[model samples]
Target: MAHTINDLVGTDIEQYLDQHEHKSMLRFITCGSVDDGKSTLIGRLLYDSKLVFSDHLSALEQDSKTVGTQGGALDFALLVDGLAAEREQGITIDVAYRFFSTERRKFIVADTPGHEQYTRNMVTGASTADAAVILIDARKGVLTQTRRHSYLVSLLGIRNIVVAVNKLDLVDYSPEVFDTIERDYREFAAGIGIEDFTCIPMSALRGDNITESSPSTPWYTGPSLIEHLETIEIADELSGRPFRLPVQWVNRPNLDFRGFAGQIAGGSVRPGDRIRILPSGLESTVDRIVTADGDLAEAVAGQSVTISLTDEVDVSRGDVLAAADEPPGSADQFECHLIWMSDQPMLAGRPYLIKLGTRTATATAATPKYKINVNTLEHTATRTLALNEIGVCNLNLDRQIPFDPYTASRDMGGFILIDRFTNATVAAGMLHFALRRADNVHWQAVEVNKRARARTKAQHPAVLWFTGLSGAGKSTIANLVEKRLHEQGFHTYLLDGDNVRHGLNKDLGFTDSDRVENIRRIAEVTRLMADAGLIVLASFISPFRAERQLARELLDDGEFIEIHVDAPLSVAESRDPKGLYAKARRGDLVHFTGIDSPYEPPESPELRLDTGGAESAATLADRVVEHLRTLGLLTPPPAG
Candidate 1:
């Protein structure tokens, strides 16, 4: 194993410790199709490196006899697959990290799952990896998942790749077989922009060509996997990029000492260096680079240190300290590449919490520009991203944040999208660049604001949002409510679903993505009308709760009233006011609520009307008007 001193007890302990401490570290991941022997390969590495303890090795042997897949031989995979479920199924389910070292270098290998369903877990393991080991069964050649993993490795910027064609003994070590697989893999890898890679033929279970060259493959001429890993040059590119330190905390043990604490994400920083705070553009000089040991003259990327600023600037947890000369850009909107990981599809216009570096912001995504078919490498058009899907989309954040392109610095550009309701991580994304419009567009101030317009009209602006299924009497009741408001000398506007589709949302369909966009458009319009001091009545079958919540967030407190026109599917279908239900049942309509699609009813609406009851549409309208009157919305402005 790369000239390692295995006799730990015999050698001078001080000398060994010094040698080990000086070795550089490399992080890598193993991934491929299921049963490609990823765990076995890692277990072999640990075993050959003499890292496993004798007691642990004894347990592995006993377990191998009971549960091994190699005909009662020492199943090395048992060393890595520690979980009971993984052992029982003989598969890798989660990312298992293992540390082993040789005389040349220290290594941390991640044994990632190869199943298509656990692709997200694989991505997590590869995100920080410097290289990737893609195993392929000699019998199967190149499968779809092989291409998928390779593409992901390329996408994650793992330039160092080694295609380990395991199970070479299964093919009788034929030179022709090895040549064919190597040719096919090289062709596929070139298509995905993998310019250079090393291919090694080996059998992990038999321990051939692992730590040493195997005599079985006489025609094969290449170093073993461990030799390549130790010799590969994985340059420290982050130190050359622009300096960035996302303040994780404001370190203040006492009033006399105050410094910002965080790991330097990119480049180096020193005392007296000019720095700028992001999203604020405030400038200052670094006062001291403090660490646990003491103040330092300099610190580079990946080092955790606290630094005090020369000026008393307003810096907090989410602020980024950057080099004044080459600072990153800030933007509220961006185009990014997203890897959807959750079971629920990613819908356009629905807000999700985005965690980038040390900052968190509310983000809404537009429909995907395209989704990549990993197997074929084609960009196919799609409205939404499903589980394990990769797509390019535009995201609008609630506020500006500093970032670099992912290619420049991963820590400054990578982000994760979390579900606001469940707090589950739903997607991982990379910032390509901020959209130009995000910088160019600025909100123009007006002298006459919403409060002045409302006072002039002598009424409070409100949005009476009526939501329900089609043929549920929502439109009819909303029309009656607007007529009553007009009769009462109030300025009102009605935005009906069908009428808006004919003009405003003419190109939109009834798909989930389109529905989110539909509600987004209507919410913006509703906000504009309310700003004009007009009572806006918006009627639509807005199906998703997320979109409904978006509309609520756009308005001021108590300004948007959600009125659920409750009606059973059976009752609404029986009414059939527009014969839409019959068309849906006959398969003439697709994505129809209560038919092929789903409709998420509001959980706690401001008002609920039982449209299926004996109450007529006019009675429901009067109930709405009375509810508004009780809430003080109907009261005229007090005299000045």
Candidate 2:
């Protein structure tokens, strides 16, 4: 039988083990915007190092013949461009990973996409890379894409940078062209605080200064691309950083064994080392280090290892393990630098899911302090963030989360925002610092109950939850009821969906999880209002029955009046007061309640009004007011 590709890869791994004993591996990524010749550069490096197998070489030769390029000679770009679409389009759309080895070093290269549209994919590749090869065409020196890639590399905390100035052949192998680019890039790097940068001139197509010195450029005397990569000192890049290991999974094999398994995000860990679990702040000593092969005395950054603690502390997934002396602080609020990726702009007070390392939590964008101008690096005071824009914003987590400053540690500080409903990543954020400090003064509040406040106000304060489909006249009817109550000298306040949204609920959206948190926050606000001796009239779509029930739980029995504003879907569609139903019907909107989403109607309600009839808003308001009066919430008429 013949060995398959998987089997061949396994065999290669075994051969690699036999050939290289006690040798460490270095993983790096090639990153740049599209048309930067990243793939060609990587292909040239692999070919010059003689790492191409016979089968791969034969395939490349066959592909070159089919493409009709010069007598079946190797088109090096074909070596890494495995995707059919990539081959046809001549652009990388996803991260293509390749592994090869030379006698001096073993390497894993992540060839990241270059297009600005694929910035998320680039970040994904650079997140795990120790060094970055930023390709720049000698013809176009220091383009916008070049600056963007450089900023990303620094943001990701990739310490070592190899600026491979490709296509020297096109520049007539002139040292001046390379020197001008090098100087221009150095100025940008210095401004961004990137101190270590190595510039090398090379022609990836002609194999000039890739593995061998190019005779074309005698003035340039830097080491070849391959030589620089083989000897670059990356061991000290993450060596001095503080230890941080985010527990991704809890490993318990049997009754006697228990351990936490995750990749070492930064620094090193050894047996008998004391570590603290953040948020819980529990201290424990490392008992043993375990891997797939066997036990080990210690593990360094980038290694995947399971660690057992001696104290038997309650540590779980989403918890971070760090050095005891320099532990991460638990904070509920953070100020972060964010790069928005969604077309829908970021609205204030909208709740979203924040994922950091392996931990996920509900968070809200508290305020948009400023949006940074990417071109000038200037801060612009803005209220909202649009797609592909960078901004500095404050985030309030639902619960306390421990994190490090991005300047201090990338692994612990970087986070991504995921749309809770679509599960699409919408933003990449870097934590600057926690806005709220733990050592701040704490104040205790005086005791006050909701029922006593309602009695003192001389009225039965209740939340009038209006539930219905869009265009069901819920907000209009709630407004009328508030007017009638005010005329009758009853203390009442109306919380309309649009009105509250402009201020209190400004940050919310129509996403499912956002909807959930929206109702949760509105319910909390309504609960506070009812406790403050006022009847709160909340006019919202309040689509889900479960969420409405959650709101009801925050109040006493009979204090939450579920007002079902009943109207047929067809009638609501025809009304289309906001023209939103038409848009939803045309599939222009996603997650629109009553169109795509299931709007659970209220089973029972204190007041049910059929807005489809000839009844006016005044008549409905009168009916609700009469009911409140009968409940003794309103004073009787003096001379009726």
Candidate 3:
């Protein structure tokens, strides 16, 4: 199947370089069910195209002989399945990327895994792909994974698709088999909004219908895989969209020059074009489009350049510089399609960090509108999304962000949800549109703000958060601390978990979702009390670190003090002050912390009081008061 490249052997090497450099690039992925020959097809494509170097070929041959599953025949799959575990298991586990070039086009093929558990890996590979080569094992026909991947490809906005019916040689190169598979895939594809796709018959191992037409099937007359890929029109429409350049860096070399640098995400820009700094609504004109090769008269999408503003406006990283008249929408809340990628199931009202383009903001996802059933393409009602699940959700961010609909521009519309505590990317999302309420809601200014309230009370307002397992003396110590502060003329209030549940949180239950909401409400209320210039003491068995962190972020730095009321499970259970542990042990109470649910102890707290030790609650409360005095929380009003 190996073919020679004329450019490699030609005397005009410089001419070849220029031709190769000018070729259009295509990014595509190989996907479908397991054992569909995705890796082998890409490897064989690389080999037949003469893109593999001789030294790499030698190592491939040696590796094939030692550990290949091809019975000593040239194992092409070995070329792309580079992971040790993947080779041992004879299955792809990660997304493997390979680059090759024909004379007409340069190609990047991502060999994504077919396992359901690794669906996130496939999404990562497909996120940037211009096309997709959905392979199917001829013997297996269409499968769940095949349908799932097809749905994902359409969801990701990849319109260019090729259904390569692989391993035809195993099925005796039957035309009937290819036709049936194509019919089934097409029927399924149409259900998921895929109106058009190309179908091909081939044996990736035998290299039939890959680089050239195979004699094994005279019934097949379509262009070869290489022929179609080389000529397929993956449209370049980004240049016609409204211009967007997310400022990645503020290039300030000296006092005289200040420029914003980033790759243009859409449309085109020139030196004299007007631009707007987004979320700020500040206008400026492009002064110079500077590049490494000096200044450019014009710059288009995908080109990285530094743009100086004619006006001295405050532009910074995470800000978008867009076409002035057609600036993108800015909103603090949006309706989005989300794909949960983490092993931990998504819980509503839990805070997460969302990163869109260069901007980052704290966000919380509401309960899903609905999750998609990949098999039937049906929508199912769900409270939370498990790994590999897709749902439509409303995300509320702390600040407004500039964005476009994902259909218009992927760079500005696509974002990832990151767990704030672990910093792991938990989900990928596509913004559909901003919520109408985001536009209507505005903060009204007040003459007596938080600072004024604090000044009137003669104290720096603060939230003393106490967290631990149930029956861990958090409320006991917090009450004592508040009493001691009140005696010294300091304004104070205590928000106890049980008392709040009796009234404010009466509707909330003990489910994980309810627990998150419970803490979220308490946090907002604590913020209000602190803003009123009161030293608010909140005592609760707030289990999750994420919710605790959320409460902390609501206040200014040093205004939120975390105090851990420490106690071993044995000690807390033995005390059984509320007899809650007994009910949990009897299986009467579900989702109880230290029984069914988990309690994430604070890794670092401002103060730790070991209730399991010999220290009395009053003594621990005294220690808390002393720590507060050191932080100046209990200091008297300063002299005028």
Candidate 4:
């Protein structure tokens, strides 16, 4: 009594259905141990979904017969891993992305590598994924890689975890083995603060319980992986946070129009919303929102728009436009989590460009205070960090920037550091919170800042730090430079080690710890003087490189110029201006540098004057002035 389509009324049902169906998309990743069938699983998903073309299927069948690991069965992994090298190695090396759609929802899956060395690639795959399909071999219940990936997914802010217990056919479809792994992983996930995870059983090779529930497992009662993926909802939390948009460009088409253009990183915005500018603290109201098609009434997170302001304020690139009533905290120091990705290790106080949102600033990271143990979840103290290491540390920037915590806004809170010389991306970081001191000690808003003061003085504020052995002519050269600057009508201040020890550092001793604190105080003082728009010259032995670097990090970009008075140790000892060197030769002083203690010379200094050679104090002072002129620090005053 049932009629076929030909006998019935329909002429083109396929075209009718295609015009009306609406499907949402979900992006997920497959990650597990090596040889755990991650790539194979993706290949199976493609073949079973009818996404593989007939021509590709013919090649796959022949390749499978010749060299496949499945005993003449089709090698499904070839569908995802297309590279010849990857196929020969029988492993997934890079992140293989595949796209397909079902009747209900479209899917984009990333098949990530399972080796330890490629763990960073896994992070790349999971960084933007909505769900993670972590494969686990039933024979090996739980592993270090499983835990490691789970921890990484949590760190990347992914909320969904689908544990696929693969290769169930290898265990004879035993419900007992499946239950044990499910229970063991549940406990582990709970311990690591991951509770929103699901577990399913399947064999990626035999096509059991992948798209359809396997008849062999009569005891299990859960939806297949595809069904679960199609139904679960991905809730976007960034859209609910406070409104913020980092200005990427200033659009000025003609005399009558100007606008700030950028993607909305957090919350929502519309006409009539009042906004505040960060670092400058200017206020304005949104007058209009323009899009490519037409004017929009409002736009939420992830939408790019050009916005006009009611007031003509000083807005520019690298500035964040935020809600006036709920502006983010602004500071130069923050404690954050960082993942090192470079071959060169992260060295303390080395300048790197940190790009957060649309803002970029010169930053220096302290040596990692502690590192997280990937397997045991223990925090261990460390002095050095290398590739694939995740650590917590403090970073100091050249100027204040605005941001929220990573938990509040992923788009605005994440940042990456780029190497200055190579321009390669070296690290990825997420802001946790601004140091409590950033809030406790707010920048005192004054009528004048360094730029205004510098204009009045006709020169920029800077610090010339001098370091060498005890009698390296550092003080002599610094004194001559200051005199030459004075003749040039420049204001300056000098902080000599002996003079500072007489008063400011009287309580400090020559021990290593005391020396560190002494330099710290001197750096703070130098920063204060620079803020007052006066050039500062600091002459110190500064036997340790770390302490000198600490001093450099306290100043603004291009504000600290290091001059190494490169006199040989013998030359310094022979021309000893201070009697301390002679006393140290008689064993009267214990920590006299170049005699009893070591002097770590600067690897690369801005100026290396050879007092041991023919360079005179006056000539060296002239060179210093010339370098300053080249840096634009000694330029003419700005015109009114």
TM-score winner: 3
The true-versus-predicted C-alpha distance at residue 571 of model 4, in Å, is 14
TM-score of each: 0.94, 0.76, 0.97, 0.76
What lDDT tens digits, residue by residue, belong to model 1 across residues 100-152?
Answer: 98888999999999999899999999999999999999999999999989988
- The stretch of ten residues in a row with the least summed lDDT in candidate 4 is 1-10
TM-score sort, best first: 3, 1, 2, 4
lDDT of 3 by residue, 447-481 (tens): 77787777777788999999999988898899999
* Candidate 2 regions with alpha-carbon error over 4 angstroms: 1-21, 67-73, 237-242, 252-258, 267-273, 286-300, 308-312, 436-471, 476-494, 497-524, 530-536, 541-640
Report per-prediction Cα RMSD to one decimal.
Answer: 2.4, 7.8, 1.8, 6.9
Q: Report, for all candidates in order, the number of backbone clashes.
A: 0, 5, 0, 0
Candidate 3, lDDT over the whole model: 0.93
Candidate 2, residues 548-602, lDDT tens digits: the string is 8768877877778888888999988899988898889899988998889878787
Which stretches of model 3 miss by more than 4 angstroms? Answer: 1-3, 7-9, 635-640
Worst 10 residues of 2 by lDDT: 1-10
What would the C-alpha RMSD of candidate 1 be, to one decimal place?
Answer: 2.4
Candidate 3: residue 612 Cα off by (Å): 1.7
